[model samples]
Target: MGATVEVEGLTKSFGSQNIWRDVTLTLPPGEITALLGPSGTGKSVFLKTVMGLLNPEEGSVKIDGVDIVSATDRETQELRKRFGVLFQDGALFGSMSIYDNVAFPLHEHTDLSASEIKRKVGEKLELVGLTGTETKLPGEVSGGMRKRVGLARSLVLDPDIILCDEPDSGLDPVRTAYIAQLLVDVNTETDATILVVTHDTNLARTLPDNLGMLFRRELVMFGPREAMLTTDEPAVTQFIHGSPVGPIGMSEEKDATPHHLLGAMDHLKLGDVPPQIQPSEGMGERAGAVRHAERLRTTPDIEELVIRQPDKELERRPVTRPAAYSAPMRGLRQVGSLFALALDVIVNIFRRPFQWRETLEQFWFIASVSILPAALVAVPFGAVIALQLGTLTVQIGAQSFTGAASVLAVIQQASPIVTALAIAGAGGAAICADLGARTIREEIDAMKVLGVSPVQRLVVPRVLATMLVAVLLNGMVSVVGVIGGYVFNVLVQDGTPGAYLASFTALAQIEDLIVGEIKAVIFGFIAGVVAAYRGLNPSAGPKGVGDAVNQSVVITFLLLFFMNFVITTLYLQVIPAKGA
Candidate 1:
């Protein structure tokens, strides 16, 4: 049986643009409910909010008895498994064949064998009329076929809830009708609760057991199909007739000047509400309808608004805008978010099915781009330190001490800082840009809807790679800088060669090198996490991605230097320098 969904007092806004407000609706279990909205009313956003992909400012989305908005990550993820989503345009992976696409959830969640997986995939494909098209890629199929394929994928898990966003978007009238009937067949067979977001008039009139319409940011009306279609509401009348006259807020025009703008809407009655679609042969009576019939006996006169109160009162407080955070509070919130994400990554690292391949790939990429820069920076940096210290020591009649000073500066400060900056500028920026691109493209949301945590699947491996590569790069920088300083002091500054080598070990302890490596690890982790965070939260456009990349680099640099100061201070205090 389908899970009952209760959404109450829901409000969502992005920046200053309010999409919808106080949206309260109940989807009867094992039924089809259509949410109709004009193009920009955030029809799709509502679906995502209910799925917990987007958080509403003031409301609760309770699936069965669990509220997704307040659920823990583990709890939220568990709840998501019960939902199957068919995104508009299919949202299929371009690289995978249809067979693999439908089989993704099975691969992610279940322990089924290859043959059993194949049989299940076949059954779902056959049900959707795509059985022989399994081997074909999504690109090879037409738009209507892609939608059917998406439908098939949604059913593979036999989910208790299904969400369809604009499934009739690009289809012709015949194709749309066929898909509408197909939905009825699916409802009858699976008995899964389904919510579809679309603005197709024909589909609204015929397909769903219940209907709701969104106009000018509010749900004008919602109830059994008959209640919505036979209404005299201007918005409903104008919408059903596809009339341009008397737009949602123009009720005055109907009374003052009704002839031309109003069209034939006044003369034409909606006749009779179309009979609800029935299941095809072999699929029994719709379970939701039987339940709906029984519910109508006591249903509060469907005439007034708020026809059915859900399981409980959703809001304990009056709806209001979420409190705005001041700059300092916002900063604290960001810090807390980053810390939480870091903890999530740490916990996920120990879980099975680790992302070793992705980690290794990122490691190699970071290493390749960083080695030359690390060496280049180290050589110039160490040479300058050596020359400056040599000149000072010679003037003070203590030229032998120049090597010790330069080595300490290079290993204790220069090596790890240089390695970290290189990683941030090269590899960290790349990670940020990659994630920003994915974020803007809705790919990350797609992964979230599919029950794949972007943090676990993508961030964990990348962060580990950054840390590992940072450690290696720090060692390379330390060695290269020491050699560069030695060569510069002996050859350019005309310092004694044996004195330079001996003096390095005199003042520098083993712990100095170990601490530098430790700093590298911390720096790498911070850089990777910062980059990943920025990448995952870029603004909504190409320009936004570019800005996030810049922000990641800037943030990583600030954090790296601050951490460097603290670590250097602590290391000096804890581990005494070698004394003569």
Candidate 2:
């Protein structure tokens, strides 16, 4: 049997912007409930809180007598297995095939064999009417198809409770109706408790056994469908009927004047309320309906169990000036988060079940994909340095010393910095974009729900691979830079080839090479961590991924310069130079 979720006095806020507060509700077991709210009313936030993805400032969410908010990490993970969530965008991993995406939860959370997994996946896909497109990637499918695939994945685990966050979003009415029917069929077959968050009036009116609505940062009402549909409450009527004439206004609140001018001036014609849609003919009675009838038999008046808690009135207050430490506080929080993420990567690195295949893929991309750009930057930089030094030595009648100066500078400074810039611009940007897209699409959240640590599966391998590649790339750049300097000194400046070759090592010691390699490793580690952090914590949409990539590049550059200065200063003071 499915579990009942009980929430009491739930409150959430971001700084001074309170999303919602003092919210209380109970989701009956084995029934479908619909939560209706306008845009920005925090319906999605409520879903996320229930899923334990976001922690609320106050309140408790209990499932099977365990409080999710206060549960230990292990307990929370175990509890999450009982839930199946379909995000608005479908949240499929773009890189995986449809078949693999559906099989992900089973592969991660179950001990089933490959054949068993295939059978279960095939069953769920057929259940969702997606039997044949198994080889297609998410990007190859339409919006409606992706949503169906998400539904299939969610059901693959046979979860006890299902949460659909705007499943009807971005779909036409016909497609929406099809999806609604699918939800009904799934619930009837499995008898799992389902909660759908949407603003579609048709869905709000017909799909659920119970209805709830949020407006102006408050849940105006939550009760059985007949009770809510028959109520004369201004906000509930205006919202469920899709009417513009009541408490709902253009600004998402009631208008001050009784008669206010506005667009879409349609009234809530009570007589026009459509009857609820029923399951298709020949479909047996829903398991939920059977459970509901059983409950009614035990207690004759079920309406008394409906919750209609009164809304708490908040006091109006004058706006106060913003705190001066807000910006610093935000900065400190980001720094702490990044540090914690890096520590997680370290802890998970040595754990059993290593991701060797993913690590190799990352290594190939970081070490090989960046070769051309590294060469391009290194060659030009070497020629420029050689030309300047050659000109200066000619004036001083020390032309042979140009080789020593060029080689030492290239080894001690140019190769490491140039390689870091190439990797940060090329490989680092790619990592950020890849991870950012996954974040915005909800793939990261899906992985977490399936008991997979993105740190272990994605971040650690990339970070280690980048660091290893940076050291190798530094060697390549150093070789190319020295050869470029040799050609520039001998062919263009008429310097003696013998002197150039013999004096190259006069000032460039083995310690200089070691310092450059060390710097490359440090820079690569910083860039990898910064890119991963920015990508994984993206804001919301496509624009958020772009913003994350931009920030990753900028922050990496700043950190590289500062770290280089500190390392160079310490090296000069602690390790004496061999030659002038």
TM-score list, all predictions: 0.86, 0.91
Which runs in model 1 stand beyond 4 Å of their true positions?
A: 14-18, 89-98, 125-150, 170-178, 248-284, 289-319, 324-328, 487-499
Error of 2 at 580 (Å): 8.3
Model 1 misses residue 204 by how many Å?
A: 2.4
Q: Per-residue lDDT for 1-580 in model 1, tens only?
A: 8999998888888755667777888898998999886667788889999999998888899999899998997899999999998888787766679999899888998999999999999998887778799899988999888888887888888888999999888788887877788888878878999999887888888888788877655666788887778876666777777766545433422332223445546754466888777888777888888887766666777675334322223322333444554456667888898888889889988986898988998899888888888889999989988988889999999988888999899999889889878999998998998788777756677678778988888899989999998999999998899999999999998889989988977788889989999999999999999999999988879999999999999999999999999999998788877873
lDDT of 2 by residue, 1-580 (tens): 6789998988887667777777889888888999987788899999989988898878999997899989998898999999998988898998899999999999888899999999999998897788999999999999889998998999999899999999998788998898899888888777889999998878988888888888766677887776678765667777776766676777755443323422233345345435656666788888776666566567657567566535333413322324523778878889999999988888888986899999989989877768889999999889988999999989999888899989988887889888779878887888899899888888898888777888999998998888888898899999999999989989999989999898977777888889999998898888889999999988878899999999998999899889988999999898898853
Prediction 2 global C-alpha lDDT: 0.84
lDDT of 2 at 384: 89
Reference-based TM-score, model 1: 0.86
Report lDDT (Cα) of residue 275, candidate 2.
63
